[model samples]
Target: MRELAGRQDDEGHGRVLERAAEAIEQASGREVIPGGDGELAGELRYALAADVVLGATYTGTLPELHPGERLALVAVCALAAAMPGCVLGDLERELTLLAGELDQAVAAGRAATAAAASRA
Candidate 1:
């Protein structure tokens, strides 16, 4: 079970990296140079600020990334930071609903596991 969980974690991390690559490719199409001197650093500051304010969840992956991938994720967070308050509020509403659903699912899974263990 631990190995399965580890593989799932690895898959999630791989998906994040793959999405970052796609973002870089899209930026390239728009003629943005992700490796421009000091650009990534500047963008990363915004990302960090967003993470602090919004709990954007990028902190875990940022330190392990290369320059290009970091640039991509930071660029995304910067864009999110730039969004209007109304849009952010709408997103918050949606996230709240999803989080509630996830919580319920987790509770159900735990209850099911407990029952199985008691019967064993």
Candidate 2:
């Protein structure tokens, strides 16, 4: 949480990291999927939701994670930090594709208009 706060770009994924971190610390390695070979957004949401539920479960519910499990949790958190950039990059690609499609559509419409004008 302190590490996230000290970050210069603390938003988006950062918010998730801080929130997820709070839950991961209390969750077993198996309980948290981190990215789970799935979409970052979905995985992050799941981890956060699970965290909240587990947090509310009761006292002593979150026992100490084994050293290996703890390592996995740390890895999950680290991967989450990178997920935001990957998601943003995918969105940019989609936007670029959409723009190209729109350009083609506009060009076709202009050509149609010109053709109709010549006939008239």
Q: Highest lDDT among the candidates is held by which one?
A: 2
How do the residues 57-117 of candidate 2 rate in per-residue lDDT, one tens digit apiece? Answer: 3343442222233333344444433443433356456434544553454355345445655
Model 2 bad stretches (over 4 Å): 1-89
Per-residue lDDT of candidate 1, residues 1-120 (tens digit) = 112122224444444444433433333232232233323334333323433212225435422332233333444434432222223345456435544553454355345445655666
**10 residues in a row with least lDDT, candidate 2:** 63-72
Error of 1 at 33 (Å): 22
Provide the clash count, candidate 2: 0
Per-residue lDDT value at 14 in model 2: 42
Q: lDDT of candidate 1?
A: 0.36
Score candidate 2 by TM-score against the native.
0.27
